[model samples]
Target: MTYSLSDFGSYWAGGEVLCVTEGAPREIAFTRDARFTYDPRGDFAVNAAYVQYFVPAQAVDAPPVLLVHGGGMAGSCWETTPDGRPGWLHRLLDAGRVVHVVDLPERGRAGFAPGHLPGEPILRSMQEAWTLFRFGPAEGFADRTPFAHQQFPVDALEAFARRFVPRWQGTAHLHLAAFLAVLDRTGPALVICHSQGSETAFDAVATNPNRITGLIALEPSAFPDDPAALETCPLVIVQGDHLDSADHWRTRADRWATLADELPDARLIDTAHEVASGGSHMLMMDRHSDQVLEATLGHVRV
Candidate 1:
């Protein structure tokens, strides 16, 4: 498929309204004569999400899409694969659909506020990602061994690892708020979210069911506390392969299945169930990424 864009834009959304007390006046300066009292205590806008959107020249009569990336990642995940291939952003635009990709607060272009959230940032190593993302087995990370049927671009593993950013555990609410803010602008839209982002996306739909009509969850790492909230939303849960190889994914797959069973309009597409050789956790970056995406898109009417 080919891609063309009539327009492109970006913006920041979601932030906290702050109230502060003034500190004792202190002198601070870039130069001796330019010295002035710099009070660090004041109202500040903290933790806002960044969004970039593309408008297809020839548009289809369909809902615009809002993509939310997974944990320790940014909107770049949808821009291109580690191997320098086109990603979901271009693919969807090629199909005549409008797309908005988001960098959740505290990741990517979204700036983080100092001392606002608690706890130090956590960083994931390539070795950990190899196992955590199911690119390969943990035991074989040293030799860079991937699963026999693994479809992730193992050769570009280092490039992929470069995208990993520091994450905080206390930002789920912030993430949800940011997603909700984006939904406020793009209502009745299709939300395509991956991994940890799925949790926030799920809650966003639950919170704004009228605005978010459909969902495409890729290898979701978390779910909402109440499954019944998604009764009115159409959901497609797409999982990668080798789920049974590790308890981490095995448990997640089971939860996804159970959630699908509980929701009337929900379905699960586990690659492991569909083919002998399936995809990895990074479905959009996998070799069969396009096919997986097309299959999932088929379920989204809006």
Candidate 2:
């Protein structure tokens, strides 16, 4: 299904902008024979990070909410559900938020092309998502039924699978560069990022704490290099369920929990413990997304 990004919110007006970034030249080896043969275009290349604004009919006295998606995903991740239902973008806008959904560099509508990015695209296999997202029994992904309280649109799993973007690994620097560009144009915003996207949000806050008023990380997989700097910004860490079993996320969650304790304005919101229905890693797309949305909005309002 095709979606017009401008119609993301229940707002009076909205628009889209392509944020460009100029950076220092970097060496690139195109082939085995070519050494440090960089593109002659200099540093000013059009980044793929697209930003959209949704202005509400009644303006709320709050910073706009900037929605950033996780790895292997794009700005479309927050636009709609696999089952063709309203998504977080709509929910936030209805709640009186000026929303900005971003397509990070090399992902989504952010002009992703082969050789444009340094690395190969990271494609998520069905099994990888099934196991990593904690949809069902990890042992037998296809055989086991999804959690009875699953918030994800499991019946329309195929649609969800198709939402995955052609994302590149080891491009956090590039993503951050473009993210900073968006932040510059939007002024202070409440950065709501998920998983890998959290890295850019965290770094953006540290880079310039004044640019971001608040930060909400949903199942953050990456962390801040300097927690001391991040502590200045109001931060909310949302950890989804089933993390205790996954070693990869288990340690990361624990580390962030510890880091949160050290920060004055930082707090961790464990969705697993917040609601009886609980939530998976992709809580925003889960069945109880509304509940999680309210939880996040609470922090943003603070």
Candidate maximizing TM-score: 1
TM-scores, all models, native as reference? 0.93, 0.83
Error of 1 at 110 (Å): 1.0
Clashes of 2: 5
Task: Report, for all candidates in order, the number of backbone clashes.
Answer: 1, 5
lDDT per residue as tens, model 1, 81-141:
9999899998999999999999999898997775677788888899888988888888888
lDDT of model 2, residue 184: 76
Report how far residue 80 has shifted in candidate 2, in Å.
1.2
lDDT of 2 by residue, 219-269 (tens): 888888888888678888887776655788779888879988999988888
Quantify all predictions' global Cα lDDT against the true fold. 0.87, 0.76
Candidate 1 to truth, TM: 0.93
Q: List pairs with backbone clashes in candidate 1.
A: 188-211
What's model 2's lDDT at 137?
62
